[model samples]
Target: MIHSCPLLRSLTLLLLMAGLTFSCQTRNSSDNTTEQTAALPPAPNFNADSAYAFVARQVAFGPRVPNSAAHVQTGNYLVETLKKYGFTVTEQPFTATTYDGKKLNARNIIGSYNPQASKRIMLASHWDSRPFADADSTQKNSPVPGANDGASGVGVLLEIARVLSQDSTKLSLGVDLVFFDAEDWGNSAVATDAYAGFCLGSQYWAANRHIPNYTAYFGVLLDMVGAKGATFPKEGYSTKNANEVVRNVWTTASQLGYSTYFIDQQGPSITDDHVPVNEIAKFPMIDIIHMQVNNLSQTFFKEWHTTEDDMDTIDPATLKAVGQTLIQVLYNEAQPVI
Candidate 1:
C-alpha cells in the first residue's frame, strides 16, 4: 500500500559503506537441493468470470473502511463464503489504534483447508479499502472504492478457495487463505515512517495468530492484481528476505507462459502487508503487486490510492493470469517433510 526503501537495505548500505571486514566462510552444501518432481495432475480451471463476480460483490458493499457498516458487512460476506466453500473459518477481531489516534475495529478472516495437516501454504490479501483518496486531485478526503487495490486480491483468493474446497484430493498439503484488514489506512505521504498505519491487520495477526503456534511453509500475498496490463516485478524486500519464494513464484509464472505480467526485474520495496508477515511472523512471504518500475512518481497503478480505482479499471484477463498461476503453484507443491 505504501512504498519505501526498506530499513534493512539502508542498514546494509551503511554497513557496506563503512567497509567492515567480513570473513568469507563456506560450507559443503547439498547439490541436490531441488524437490523431487511428481507427475502433476491437471489443475482446476480458474474462472475469470467467477473471480470478477467476487470482486464485484465487494465493490457493491461500498468502501470497506474500518468501523464502517460496509466493512462489517463485507467481512461477514467473506466468512460466510468461506464456510459455504467448506473451509474451517476463523475470525480474529481486534481494536487497532491508527496513526492519527483513531481506533479501528479490524478483523482478520482466515479459511483453513485440511487443518489437521502439519504442512501448509498460506495465501493472504488485504480486504479493507483506503479511508481517504489522498492521491487524487479531486475528492481527496473521500474514501477509495478499492475495486483493484483491495477487492481484486481477495476475489482471486476466494475463487481459489472455492476450487480447492470442491477438489481437496488434488493437493495434499493444507491451504490457508487470509483476508487482512486495515492495510490501506496509512498516510505515508505525510509521515516520516513509511510503515505506520499500514498493515495493521497483518501486524495484529503476526503477533497473535488465529491458531496457536501457527506456521506455514511459506506465504504469498496478492495486491493490485486485477488492473489492465499489470506488471509485477520482484520487489526489493521480497528479494532481500524471501529470495527463494520470489524465484519460485516468478519461475512458475514464466513456465505457465505468464511471463509478461510477472516480469524479471527489480522493483522498489513496498511497505505492504507482506513486510509485517515476514518480519513479525517470521514467515517467508512474497508480494505479487502491480508496480510501475519506470516511473518513480507513479510507482503503483495510476488509479492507486485514488477515487478512480473503481470496477472500470479491473480487467478479467489480468485476474486470470494471476489466479491461474497461483493454482498451478499451490497444486504442484508437494507436502514438505516437516
Candidate 2:
C-alpha cells in the first residue's frame, strides 16, 4: 500500500538520488566488467506449480497480521522450510511501534546460499499481509488474505531456494532471500500519517543490517507479483533510484519472452520497503511490483489491500515469469574476485 502525499513525494526524490549514486558507482567499476565473456550456466527451470503451492500455504495459514499467532507460526514455517532447502537461516527479531501506537513483535527471516562467495544478490519480499482491507468497497475494514500482495513474492523466492538446493553446483554467486515482517501494518489511507506506518521491518533492517557491513551487487524486491495477468511496469522510484538494475531485470525478462508482463512503461512512485533499503542501507535496489496504467486507483494491483486478495487471484504464470527472470539475472553475473 502507498500514499502519494506531497511530503512523501519530496522524500522519494531525495532517496532516488542517493540510490542512483550508489548504483552508478557499482556499474562503473571496471572489475564488474570484463572484455572476455564468461560461460554462463543454463537457465534453471522455474516451477510455477511449486511456487503457487507455496503461496497457497501462506494463505492457508490465514492473514499473517503482525503480533498474531498466525504471524508467528508462519515465521517458523518459513525458517524451517528454508532450512530444509539447505539455506543458512538467520532470524532478526525486534519490536516496532506502528502509527496507531501498537507494539509489534516482528521478525525478518534471512536465508543464505553459497555464503562463501563474495559476489552476492539480495532478493526480498514482505511476508506479513495488511491488517485492513481498506481498498475493498465491500469489506473496507477487514483483514486481507494477501495471496498476491504478501505471499506471491515469498512463494517465488522459496521455490528458487528449493531449486538452488536441488542443483547447488549450478549457482556461481551467493544469494540472500529475505522475508521482511510488519511491512503491511501501516496506517490506512484515511490516516493523517500513512507513510510513517509502512515498511516497519525494512526500516529496522536498513538501520541495523543483519550482517555487519553487509553489501550486495544489487537487490530486487517483489510485491504484488502473483496476480493473474500481472504487469510490472518500471516503477517511478526504481527508475529514479536504480535505473540500471531495472534495465537489467527488464532486459532479462524480455529476453525470456516475458516482455508482455514486464512492460517498458513508467509507474507511480511507491513508498515500499525498497525505499528505506535504498536510502538507509544504501543498496542499489529496485522494486518489481504490479501496476496498472489504466486503473482507477493509481497505487497498486486491482485487488490490493482488499479481501479479494485471496488464493484464487494468484496465477502461476506470473510467478514463473518473475522467478525465471531472477534466475537468469543471477546466472549472468560474473563471479566476484575472491
Clashes of each: 0, 0
Give per-residue CA lDDT, model 1, range 1-338, as digits (tens). Answer: 32456666777776664453332211112212122222233678899999999999999999999999999999999999999998999999999888888999999999998888878999999999999998899899999999999899999999998888787565778899999998888877554555866888999999999987788999999999999999999998999999999998888787666889999999988989999889999989999999987886889999998999999999999999999989988877863444
Candidate 2 wrong stretches, greater than 4 Å: 1-41, 188-194, 334-338
TM-score of each: 0.86, 0.85
Number of clashes found in candidate 2 = 0
Residue lDDT tens for model 2, 146-228: 99998999999999999989974568789999898899877655445535588989989998888998988889999999988
Q: What is each predicted model's overall lDDT from 0 to 1?
A: 0.89, 0.87
- Model 2, residue 24: displacement in angstroms? 39
User: Largest TM-score belongs to which candidate?
Assistant: 1
- Candidate 1 clashes between residue pairs 3 or more apart in a chain or in different chains: none
lDDT of 1: 0.89
Q: How many Å off is the CA of 329 in candidate 1?
A: 0.6
